[model samples]
Target chain A: MRNRFNEQLEQLNVELIKMGALCEEAISAATKAYVEGDRELGERARSLEQDIDHKERDIESQCMKLLLRQQPVAKDLRAVSAALRMISDMERIGDQAADIAEIARYMEKSAILRQVPMEEMALAAIKMVTDSVDSFVRGDLALAHSVIAQDDQVDSLFLSVREKLTALIAGGENGGLCLDLLMIAKYFERIGDHACNIAQWVEYAITGDYEDD
Target chain B: MRNRFNEQLEQLNVELIKMGALCEEAISAATKAYVEGDRELGERARSLEQDIDHKERDIESQCMKLLLRQQPVAKDLRAVSAALRMISDMERIGDQAADIAEIARYMEKSAILRQVPMEEMALAAIKMVTDSVDSFVRGDLALAHSVIAQDDQVDSLFLSVREKLTALIAGGENGGLCLDLLMIAKYFERIGDHACNIAQWVEYAITGDYEDD
Candidate 1:
C-alpha cells in the first residue's frame, strides 16, 4: 500500500508538470501570434488552451481520487490538496493566454504595438509560470519564493507599458490599437499574478505554511 | 457518527453563506463608490474585501479538516472538494470588487462616468454571486443554471459600455475617466465569470457531472 501511494504521488507530479508545460506552450504560441501577426498561431494557442483545460480536469480528478482512496494524512494530504489548488491558477493562465491570442487574431496587422514591449512581459510571465510549477514538483521553497518575488517586476513592467500607451494616446494615437494593447498588458500582468498564486500554493504544499495568507 | 458528519456539513454551508454575503456587500459598496464618486466608500469596500479574504482561509481550513478527519467517500468527498474549488472563485470576486473600488478611489471626482450604466452591471454581478452560493448550499440546480445563463447579459453589458466609452473618446472626451470606467466594467464582467464558475462547481458537487468541459 505504501509503495503504491508513493508511486501515485510521483504520477501526480508528472501530470502537474505536463499541465504546466501546456500553459507555457499556450502562452508562447499566443505571444508569437501577437508579435508576428500570425493569425494561424492564435489557432494553435487556442487549441493548446483547450488541452490545458482538459489536463486540469484530469489532474484534478487524479488528486481527488488519491485523496479519497489513499486517505493520506499530514504532508501527503497537503501535497495533494495543493495540487488541486494549483491547477485552477494554471487554468486561468491558459485562459489569459488564449485571450491574448484571441486579440492577436483580430488586431490590425499594422498596429504600432512595438513600443509596448509585450514580448518581454510575456517571457517573464511564462518563466514565472514554469518556475512556480517546478517549485511545486521539486519541493523547492527557494524557487517558489523567487517566483513570488518576481511578480513585482512583471507588475512594474505592466505599469510602464500602460504609461507608454497612455502617453501615445495623449499624442493622438489610434484608440483601437491602444485599447487592445492595454488589454494584452493587463492579461500578462494577471498571468503573473496567477503564477504567484501557484507558487504560494507550492509553499503550503511543501512546508505546510501558506505564507501569503 | 453519521449525525456528527452531517452536522459539520451543515456548518460548512453556513460559513459559505456568510462569505457570500461579504462578497455581495463588498461589491455593492464598491459599485456605490464608483457611481457616487465616494472615496470613503472605497475604503469600506476595501475593508470588506479583507474580511472576505479572511473568511476564505477560514472556510478552506474547515473544509480540509472535514475531509481529513471524516474521510468522506463518494458524494461526500465530492461535496467537500467542490467547496474547496468554490472558495477560490469567491475569493476572486472579492479581489475584483476591491480592484474596482481601488480605481474609484483615485478617479477624478468630476469624471463623467454616468453613461456606462455600471450600477446595473454591479447589481447583476452581485445577484449571480449570491445566487451561485445559494444554489451550492441548497443544491438547487435550477438556480445554478440561471446564474450560468446570466453571464451573457453581463458580458453584453460590458461590450455596450466599452462601445459607449469608445464613442465618447472619439468625440474628444477625457481618456482617463473612460479608461477607469472600462476597467471597472471589466472587473464586473470578470466577477460574473467567477460566479459562473462557482455555479458550475455546484453542479459537480450535487450531480457529479462536470458539464462545462
Candidate 2:
C-alpha cells in the first residue's frame, strides 16, 4: 500500500507538470494571436481552452481520489493540497488566456489595434507564469520568492499600459479599440496575479506559512 | 474530547462570522465615504481593517488546532476547512474595501468629485457581501446560488461605470478626475468578486463542489 501510494503521488506530480505546460502554451498562443492579429490562432486558442478545462477537471479528481484513498498526512498532504490549489490558479491562467483570445477576435472584427504595449504586457505575464510553475516543480523556494517580487514589475507594466490607453482614449483616438486594449491588459495583469498566487501556495506547501499582500 | 472539539468548531464559526460582519461594515463605510466624499468614513474603514486581519489570524490558528487535534472527517472536516477558506476570502473582501477607501482618499485629495456611479456600484457590492455571508451563516445553497448569479450584474455595473468614466474622460469634461472615479468603481467590482468567492466557498462547504464560471 505504501509503494502504491507513493507511485500515485509521483503520477500526480507528473500530471501537474503537464497541466502547467498546457497553461504556459495557452498563454503563449493567446498572446501571439493577439499580438499578430491572427484570427486562425485565436480560433485555435478557443478550442485549446476546452482541453485545458478537461485537464483541470481530471487533475482535480485525481487529487481528490488520492486524498480519499491514501489519506495522506504531513508533507504528502501538503503536497497534494498544494497541487489542488495550484490547479485552481492554473485554470484561472487558462481563463485569462482565453479572455485575451476573445479580445483578439474582437480586435479582428474592429480592424483597429490600440497599441503594442498589450503584447509586451502579455509576454511579461507569461514569463511570470512560466517561472512560478518551474519553481513549483523544482521545489525552489528562492526562485518562487524572486517570482513573487517580479510580480511588481508586471503590475507596473500593466499600470503604465492602462495609463497610456486611457490617455489615448482621452485624446479621442480609437476610443472603443483602446478600451478593448485596456481590458486585454487587465487580463494579463490578472494572469500575473494568478501566477503570484501559485508561487505563494508553493511557498506555503514548503514552509507552512501563507502571506497576503 | 468530542465536546471540546465541538466547542472549537463553534468558536471558529463565531470568529468567521465576526470577520464577515467587519468586512460588511468596512464596505458599507467605504461606500458611504465614496458617496458623500467623506474622508472620515474612509479613515474609519482603514482603521477597521486591522481588526479584521487580527481576527483572521485568530480564526486560522483555531482551525489549525482543530485539524491537528480532532482529526475531523466527512461533514466536520468540510466545515472546518470551509471556515479556513472563508476567512481567506473574507480577508480579501476587507482588502477590497480598504482599496475603495484608498480611492476615496484619492478623490478627497484631488478634490474633484463628480459623484460618478461609484455609490451605486458600492451599494450593489455591499449587498452581495451581506447576502453571501448571511447565506453562509444559514448554510443556504439557494442564497449562495443567487449570489453567484448576481455577480454578472455586478460585472455589468462595473462595465457601465467604466464606459461612463471613459466617456467623461474622452470628452475632457471631468478635468481628468474620471480616472480616479474609474479606480473607485473597479475597487467596488473587486469587492463584489470576493463576495462571490465567499458564497461559492460556502456552497462548497455544504455540497463539496466548486462551481466556476
- Give the proportion of true interface contacts each model preserves, from 0 to 1: 0.08, 0.11
In order of the candidates, what TM-score does chain B achieve?
0.97, 0.93
Which residue runs does candidate 1 get wrong by more than 4 Å? Answer: none
Every prediction's TM-score for the first chain? 0.97, 0.94
Q: Best-fitting candidate, measured by lDDT?
A: 1
Candidate with best DockQ: 1
The CA lDDT of each predicted structure is: 0.88, 0.78
Residue B145 Cα positional deviation in candidate 1, in Å, after optimal superposition: 1.1
Tens-place lDDT per residue, model 2, A1-213, is 889988998898788888888888888889878877788887777766777778877886687667666777777778877787788778778877887899788674443353546767877888888888889889999988987998998889877876776666566665546666766777888899889989998898788777766
Our tally of clashes for model 2 stands at 0
lDDT of 2 by residue, B36-139 (tens): 77899999898878788888878866765676667777777778767866787777678778878887776644433443566677778888988898898889
Once model 2 is optimally superposed onto the true structure by TM-score, how far is the C-alpha of residue A139 displaced, in angstroms?
A: 1.1
Question: How far off is model 2, as Cα RMSD?
Answer: 3.6
